[model samples]
Target: MTPVTYATALYRNLLRLNGLGYLFRNVSIGMTDHGDVRNRGFLLKIKCDSVTVLRNVRQKFKTLNLKDKSVARIFCRTLHGSTQNEHNNNIHDIDYITFTNCDNDTCKILRNELLLLPNFVSEEEEKQVVLEVEPYLKRLRYESSHWDDAIHQYRETEKLKWSEKNAIIIQRIRDVAFPQGVKQISFVHVLDLKKEGFIKPHVDAVKFCGNTVAGLSLLSSSVMRFVNTDNKAQFFDVLLERRSLYIMKDTARYKYTHEILKDEESVFKGKHIPRDRRIAVICRNEP
Candidate 1:
């Protein structure tokens, strides 16, 4: 490594050592990968009893250099309920929270009530249902093909057809998820995204719908990102598991922009999962 790089790494290690015992009177040092400084390096946070000790550590950290080091290795570990907990709480300012284990029987019932279509259909039943609803699906408008270079396709309709199974499920989701309850279903959209197709960041149009929105994932798993519109630097990513149901209310619905990213796969909770042809059913409340 270059001299400059070596010095930088040493400084970080010194700060960590200070966090362990030396400089701060009574504080814990928490490390994070989300530091604004250094862009790619870990950030060391010193939570201490006195502001004076904190000040001293920062000043001392500036002048230090590695005197005896030929090579440097940095060891990192997350403090349980520290950094991860704070991150979860920050993004969930709204009533929005991700339900990862939607396949469970209990969660399946909740999904039926709140976000997804109840009673999963068999493959034969699905083919019949598609045939029955093919007319409306064709009539629905296609989203901008330029957005995905024609790789992904989508069609949506605001009007409900009683013959379609999704129409009934949308009403059920609205009834059980809304507090004041839905006066009417405002809009429902179905997205057909290829492995390479994804949406960019944009908040939903408030004039078209109310404050609550529910979505159902079908066919594949992908990552959805939420960015705080008021604070562009603040953002979070949630994994949308196949057959999963997710809801956005309060700040998440009105104050943040949501998107499906362009990557073909994502790593969540340490497992690498690939994206496939994904179909999402999005329902909005009546304005």
Candidate 2:
């Protein structure tokens, strides 16, 4: 779980207990006034007798704010139950999908594993693949019905037969990246994009595809935002770099709808990354 998630969950539980008269209410976050640096970490001094509750709260605090420098040292103190707790409103309720960034340690570990490899293709390989796929871009038709006229030309290939090198890459992905019980994936959908091309938020039809979908991003970097179509408040963004591989399974695939903005950039970790002409080779197992 991310720091934001841990903090949000702890805040939720505290609110629940406060409602039941179990917790001293008005929770406030502030810094310490201690003299020495040794005794200077933020304190959560709640007047409570429940040892389990205290332990859980401290653990959550440690995970949520200790590592990230941008987060504040929140000292939660409970006041009378009648007091309105403004501190509780710090985090928005987020539950549409699970996300992990490329910078995360867990994601780094997983990238080395079989299930989710990030930069599976080399830069040279990406260039070659782009060259091979460029010829089919001419066959693309303008999709005026779905998107704005300025940003909607795309070519979705019919069932494709891979070349010798492409077939080898697929075999390797299957052997290492795919989990057991997954059927073989035979075809790929190559979507060629125009300069300002983008697709709006939508989920793939489960009737035609499997639970797991693997995509290889080539030629450009872009930001794809996954939004909860129902709530609209809960959403997450992921940066898709050239030569990277991404996997969407279970909740990420079925619950959240993904979209890319036309003529836009995504801000991630305080850096603004621009979008470019991207080719997404989407591979899905038969359901």
Candidate 3:
């Protein structure tokens, strides 16, 4: 639980950026120190001991025409078809679609999660992973050859904790998941491969502010392909390079389907590059 130092009566209004909603109770409208964070106390009562407020917020969100489907449609068109560094032959997919790469004329509503997960990796563990993770990833490549067309994951439920570094990341992710008094949580370390070493077109089922967020910490070299499910599945690839952190939210998580290519032998400008094992830590939140 976070020690809230906020006060109520400072909230101006509420807004939705990427389909996730927040309880923006007042905190900065020149309120008094009330001996503690008023916003936290207010949120404590508003979100309450149950998820009723959460459900209500979601229902009202649908009426505003800000549902996931509507957001996903706009997400697809904003891409204007593909990104830079994407290969013509590599198929791709995305779980969360963002308007990060849109034209200047577009609106930019960067939703600020009052609950921002500031730190990703712990200090000592960060050093440890930096030193040893590469070797493990090297081993993983050969090991991956034995598995095909599957997703591998770990737990973030109330059952166990990962390495100390992972445990730290897990806790922060947990804050995002059970921001309210949630019931259950499940975390995983997942990797979806290209059956032939490349993925076909597909959509992801990771939800944020609702179910799960694929908190990806890239450990190897790979590309994620994004395509519009309603269209011809025309695509683009995103490079999940070494040590990158990606957070796919909202419609991007469920709409605008995506996949990792499984192309092992193909004509990519008449060149051939063997596919390597791709590894990701897939943490989940369930309630």
Which scores greater on lDDT, model 1 or model 2? 2
Instruction: Name the best candidate (by TM-score).
Output: 2
Worst 10 residues of 2 by lDDT: 73-82
RMSD of each: 20.1, 15.1, 12.6
Supply every candidate's count of residue pairs whose N, Cα or C atoms clash at under 3 angstroms. 0, 0, 38
Clashing pairs in 1: none
lDDT for each residue of candidate 1 in 1-287, tens digit (9 for 90 to 100): 43334333333333332333233234455544443332223344556566754565544432221112221221111121112332343322212223332223322222122222222223443354445545766666556564434223455444445455544445534533354323646656656665667777777777877777777666777777666676666665666766555666655666667788665446555566688767666667677
TM values, all candidates: 0.50, 0.56, 0.43
Can you tell me which runs of candidate 3 are displaced by over 4 Å? 1-159, 176-184, 192-196, 205-211, 233-237, 262-276
Best by lDDT: 2
Cα lDDT of all candidates, in order?
Answer: 0.48, 0.51, 0.35
Task: Report how far residue 202 has shifted in candidate 3, in Å.
Answer: 2.5
Cα lDDT tens digits, model 3, 1-287, are: 11121212111112222233343431222222233221221122234222554454333322222212222222232122222112332212222222333322211111221111212333444455434344443344433332333332211112254576455544544443332344444635444343345554555433433443545444344445555455543433354434334444444445545555444532232343334544455554452
User: Candidate 2 lDDT (Cα, whole model)?
Assistant: 0.51
TM-score attained by model 2: 0.56
| TM-score head-to-head 2 vs 3, winner | 2
